[model samples]
Target chain A: MSKIAVIGLGSMGYGMAQSCLRAGHDTWGVDINADAMARFAAEGGRAGALPADLDIAMIVVLNAAQTEAVLFGETGIVADLPKGAVVIACATVPPEFALKMQERCAKAGVLYLDAPISGGSVKAANGQLSIMASGSAQAFAAARPALDATAETVFELGDSAGAGSAMKAVNQLLAGVHIATMAEALTFGMTQGVTPDKFVEVISKCAGSSWMLENRAPHIVDGDYTPRSSVNIWPKDLGIVLDIAKSAQFSAPITAVALQQFVAAAGMGFGGEDDAAVAKVYARNAGLTLPGEDA
Target chain B: MSKIAVIGLGSMGYGMAQSCLRAGHDTWGVDINADAMARFAAEGGRAGALPADLDIAMIVVLNAAQTEAVLFGETGIVADLPKGAVVIACATVPPEFALKMQERCAKAGVLYLDAPISGGSVKAANGQLSIMASGSAQAFAAARPALDATAETVFELGDSAGAGSAMKAVNQLLAGVHIATMAEALTFGMTQGVTPDKFVEVISKCAGSSWMLENRAPHIVDGDYTPRSSVNIWPKDLGIVLDIAKSAQFSAPITAVALQQFVAAAGMGFGGEDDAAVAKVYARNAGLTLPGEDA
Candidate 1:
């Protein structure tokens, strides 16, 4: 019923494009990678330049820079979008950046929604992601079709741009730190002869566990570092958090320490592996063999 | 109906003593503070010095030092306990320290059960605590009555002294880090204009959440600092974690960073306040007012 374009056809974007198509929307998928574009086209997504009469432009790029490049860069889409159309930005950018983007979009007669998403790749493919969204009422009305197609939960955070991104930063702060800390505790337990399997078995029921612990510990238990969310994500996400903390003069020591661990994991060449592979850093440091790492 | 003595009639110990009495045991409550002992006595607990013929002695003291003083120091009770009796040590102590106590008790022909408890003061009162316990088969057999009386979940970790304490350390490592991290995330949310109430509501449903967040965030939302668990407990517990990590040559930066926040909270004279009051340190740094604090 709606004409939609999903920019930056990464793991999340490609799935979101599929969800739009599944909902019977006229969907266009755009990516720098030719393979991704070809794959989306093979999956029945439209492959041409987005039609100017698009109802929604879902930006699922990596960061503010990529988001801006897509919306306001050379061959910018927002200026090309018809009046009253909505641009849903799904990058984990700062609240200030989101607000600024909203202001710029408003000046161009384009509605912008701060709509950073969660629930990861699998959920994205299943049309079951959670969206933290805040924008004008008109923007919400315009973006409804895409939202209804993609999200299982939509937290309407506020009536403006900054609040949704603010909440996203808060979630990222906790998520990144928890993932690294799970690695720390799992590996620390290993030193005491608590195997990864036992760590998952017992701690999951104890007061010590977190959502990240229950979700990611199995990766270490199986020695599977396939990047559900890669080691590279923490540096970028926690960096956004630290930057926001710096701007707010907030001291987040635990977040800082967690950032260092992720950086260390990346430094050790595990950047492309699953974020749970942060445990491999601890495993190596303590000379312990993680599951599947035994020689 | 086993004859048992519970040392240290503090909040946790008193509840444990009541649980023992409720289980039809002849439970003796002892404390340096006569008021605590008298209070438990008024609640149907036996009031007297521990009888030497005590079949089991449960030491529910505060720390490694207190556990040591109560068991082996001047007027040490381990020597006074009857031969073949069991001592269920319910203090959070280093695995090495638990092993040492087990050895000392063995020399006196006594059984020692390394039994560190969880579930806090409320669970203790309800006889629903989780006990992480290890020792010989005889020690488990002898302490079975007390375990049944006081614990709803008893983790029989191993038939040795160190494993129980080691498991407790692992739990504490996860737990202490979690509490501090919850405070960190909640306060970070505040800096982003996310109210304490909203932070609790939203994060509790997200992957960012932990058991500690659900348990402690309400105290912040209500602005109450009643000492469910004191800020001082973290420095002590996380210090034990850091010490163990050091011994294992395991680097625990996140735990180390979290420990510093609690140390700061303690240094700011909030050592007596509830552990949730660590948010005060964040609030002060960011010039944000928490729900219960004076702006």
Candidate 2:
């Protein structure tokens, strides 16, 4: 029922675009890759130049800079959007950047919802993602259909742009660190005669478990480094955290250390692999072979 | 009913002693502090020197050194314990130390259960702690009555001493880092207009949460740093982690960074406060005042 444009056809964005189409929206898929656009069209997604009468432009780009370029760059969608159309920014950007985007969108007669998402690619595909959303009432009203289509849970954080992003940053800080810690713990257990399967079995039931641990540990157990969420994500996401921390003068030493591990994983050429591959970093350092990995 | 002695009537040990009593055991409370012992006695804990005929001696002492001294020092209890009496070592010591204790206890005709506990003081009092246990079948058999009384979940990881401590170390690696990361995220949220209360309310629902975050974030929101688990615990626990990491030649950068934050908190004179007060390091570094602290 709504005219929606979803830019950035990455794993998350592609799924979200499908969700909008699945909800029977007048959806438009935009991506740098023509293959993604063609694939979306093949999957019954509407294809055309985004209609000037667009009700929502959901930007799911990589970072703050890309989001800015998408909105204010040459041929920016904000210029194409009609008055009162909403822009749901779904990047894990800093709160300040979100506030700035909200202000810029307002100047263009657009409502901006700082709606960063979680629950990863699978949930994104299932239309069961969690959206940490904050915006003005008008922005929420404008963006409701896409939200209803894509999110099973939408945390309505506050009536401001940055609050949603702030909460997302908090979540990323924990999520990123937890993934690395899971790897560290799992491999450390390997050094002590606790097998990968047993590490998964025991720790998941114990107080040591996290959402990330539960989600990612099995990847290591199966020796499957296929990217459910790649090791490359942490550097970008934790980079956002460090940027926010630096700006706020907040010292996030744990987050800083976690960033280093992901960097190490990336450095060790596991960047494109599943984030759980971080266990390999620990295992390699300690001379322990994880389940399914070579000696 | 088995005859049981719970040494070291600290917050955790005292509650454990009460749990043993509640389970219908003839529980003896032992502590260097006469007041703790008297308090336990007033609560119907049996008063006497530990009996030589004790069926179980649960040494819920402080650290590796204390646990060692309690079992093998000149005035040690292992020599005093009857043959086949189980000594449940419920402190977070190294796995190597645990194996050493098991060997020493074995020489004295005793069984040793490497039973490090979780669920904190509240669960300790309720006789519902989770114990990560590994030892011989005979050791488990000898410790059954006390184990049944005190633990709701007992992970029988291996039929020897080291695996339980290894798992505990893995757990401590996650838990200690999680506490600091919670502090980091909570304070980071404050910089972006997310109140401590709202941070708790929102993030708890998001994927960014951990077991420690749910457990410890409330302490910060209430601005109560009452040492439910003090800052001093991390340096010791994560020190154990790094020691184990070093022995295995495993590089734990995140654990190293988290340990430093707790150490800084100790230096800031908040060491005696709850581990949640690690937020103080972030707060002071960023010039942000937390909920109850004087601005």
Candidate 3:
């Protein structure tokens, strides 16, 4: 069993930490939230400070800034990490940022793997997430135990850092836009006479259906905006997409409009609700009532 | 066997006519294109004018105007159609227009089944199309032979004309946005080194995928613009969606943007190409060369 530290014990991170611990790794879970750390300890995660000879540091933080803070900021673990230890970065960040982190880690004789994850919290806890990963062979070897623990499918994208993050951005672009479009069409159907249940029943079998639509539309049908994935995710994820598109001079008009809808959803204070709650913006705009709403 | 007339022998119409003939119906195929009609005749379709005692007049025309023109224009078929014969309207039109046509057809003692078809030309030819239908019980009974011959799945939406058309518009809204978004994400991926081939390989297995993406991305990977479903269909279909949304006071911003991308593709002179050619818009904007293009 490898020695591993999984920083940021949020939903995904906590589940990943659990997967590592379940796989018989000596795993430490770190988070600013003490309760999260305590809960992980209660679930058989290693207690106390991270060991110096850690084999893998899996950072499942939110964004680039937080990822950097955890790796290289004051009280950062990169300097504390033993040489040859792999830092498996799992956050969705720009490709350039991943490359930069890889370069800085390499200068300190540390291996870095750009590994952005797919599938959600449940998948993470089940050790069935898909990981899009790229780095040196040594990085891959050092990170293998944790990767084996947490991921069901590991797409070896390239022999470098940027490719995994690039693919993740591409995925986030499609995923975020799909969620918003599902909301747009479902609510638009409501403006006609198609009920939310009927929309789910019929469209899921039709060509219009997406993975996100099939996964999230039932939440709207049940009127449960319990935030499996929140509306706040789009503005951040699509922001990365548009930023990347701008640098490449690519025109992503559909993604642009999809981002605006999510922004509107956030502005309407549904940011913390389920991403399907984006339908509420359309429902409100058209003066229609969603399922489970006050009529 | 029922006496049937299948009008508008285009790709979808001609295939539908073949399906009717295959089902042992005494079917007549009519089209402005003589070669199409001649081809249908060679395939066992009956020749000459539609019979006066026809049990079904299935108008598989392009849009609402053509549907209206075929039914009530100069030399209109409704005047020639026998009483109680069903008119299976298979084009995408506004729900309001479907209701209006139902009213007009009812005055002539004729039945109208608002049956907007899905599945493309291949399924049309194979008699495996999905038909979203709504009409009176008598209308459905009259149209049953043709529907049975042509549709693999028939969604009986409601007891009237508007519901089928409304559901179709919703499907079109999502389908159209999905096609454009696939192009958007695919080319956007290209800008970041995610090749079209790798894109289809990976995203099809991920949550980012849609039915349209799985169906259309291959055309991009092969760089084939063969018109399985041409780019021209979107402007007309999404135009109907935005028009209906406007009437409903529904703000469909994502659909509006998707419409613009299709418009741009048409403006770029890809109207005759497959719908996947929408990727060319993003490819051109980003200075990327798609497969099989002169780089």
Candidate 4:
């Protein structure tokens, strides 16, 4: 079994850390939150200090800034890793930032795998996350054990760092826009007297349906805004997408408009609520009450 | 056999007319185009003047204006129909317009079924179209025979005229946005080196997918924009959506953005091309050549 360190014991990272432990890896869970680290330790995970012969450092942090800090900051773990060790970056970061990280890792005689994950926290715990991965063959070979334990599908996008992150940005573009569009359609239906329940019932079977719609619309139907994925995610994720598009001179007008809706939702203090709560922005604008709202 | 007249024998109407004929209705196909009329006549459809004893006048025209023209304009058929005969209006119209037509038809002692259809022309021919219907019980009873002939599922929305049209508007809002978002995502993937074929294979199975993505991405992969549903349909359909949204004072920013993409596609002279050709707008904007284009 490989010695694996999973930094950032948030929803996705904690599940991934558990998956590694379940797969018989000598797994370590690291987080700023002491309670999360203690919880992982209770669940047969190593909690304190880095192992000298770490095989894989799976960074499942939030974004580029956090990922960079966890990797190369003053008290970073990259300096603590042995030669030939792989750093599996599982953050949704810009492709250019991923490339730069790979270069820095190379200079330090460390392998870097650009691995942005999908399928959310539940899938991560079940070891069924989809990992969009790219790096050198050596990095792939080094990261294989951790990947096998954590991912159901690993899309080997290219023999480099940037491609996987690029694909992830593309996915975020679609996924973010789809959630907002679902909100727009559902609330627009409300204005026309189609209830949230009926909107979910009919549209889920129709060509109007998306993976985001089918998955998220039911949350609106149930009037549960508990953040499976929060409204705050879109501004960050779609912000990365639009930034990438801007760098490439790509005109993503739909993505732009969708980003605005998420921003509106965030501005309305629904940022921490479920992304389905974007429908509240529409409901408020049209003066219609959603399923569980007071009129 | 019920005596039925299907006006505007275009792709959807012609197939619906054929479905009626197949169901053993004495169906009369009417169109301004002589070729369409001749074709339907060869397919066992009556190509002639309206039968005065018409039990069902199914107006499968384009929009609100055309539907109004066919039912109440110069040389209208509503005055020609027998009293108690039903006018099964199968066009995507404003709910208000539908209620207006229903009220007007009531004055002429005719029942009106506000029926807006879904599923494409293929489903239309196979008599498996989904009909969103609402009207009085008398109208439902009168239109039942024609509905059974042409629709696999008839959603009886309400005991009035507006609900069916309202649902149709909701469906169109989601459908239109999903299509444009698919193009946006696919083209964005192209900018990231994900080929059109790989996109269909991967994204179709991912949370990024929509029903439109799975259905229309193949047309792009094959480089065939053969107008299964033309780009021209969106400006009309989404225009109707925005109109309805405006009436309710609903802000549909995502739908508004998607509508602009289709309008751009139409302005790019791909109005007659498959709605999938909205990808062309993204491709052009990004300087990316899609598969089957001379790069």
- By lDDT, the better pick of 2 and 3 is 3
Candidate 1 lDDT for residue A241: 94
Which candidate number would show the highest lDDT if scored against the true structure?
3
Docking quality level of the chain pair in candidate 4: high
After superposition, the stretches of candidate 3 with alpha carbons farther than 4 Å from their true spots are none
In candidate 4, how many Å is residue B203 off? 0.9
Candidate with the greatest DockQ versus the true structure: 3
Q: Rank the candidates by lDDT, best first.
A: 3, 4, 1, 2
Q: In candidate 2, what are the lDDT values of residues B165-202, reduced to their tens digit?
A: 99899888989988888898888888878898988887
Residues A30-54 of candidate 4 have per-residue lDDT tens digits of: 9999999999999999998988999
| DockQ for each model | 0.81, 0.79, 0.90, 0.80
lDDT of 4: 0.92
In model 4, how many backbone clashes occur? 0
RMSD of 2: 1.3
| Deviation of model 1 at A220, angstroms | 0.5
Q: Note the residue pairs that clash in candidate 1.
A: none
**Interface RMSD after interface superposition, model 3:** 0.7
List candidate 1 segments past 4 Å from native.
none
Better of 2 and 4 by DockQ: 4
Candidate 4 lDDT over B137-216, as tens digits, reads 99999999999999999988899998899999999998899899889988988877788888887777778888898999
Give the candidates in order of DockQ, highest first.
3, 1, 4, 2
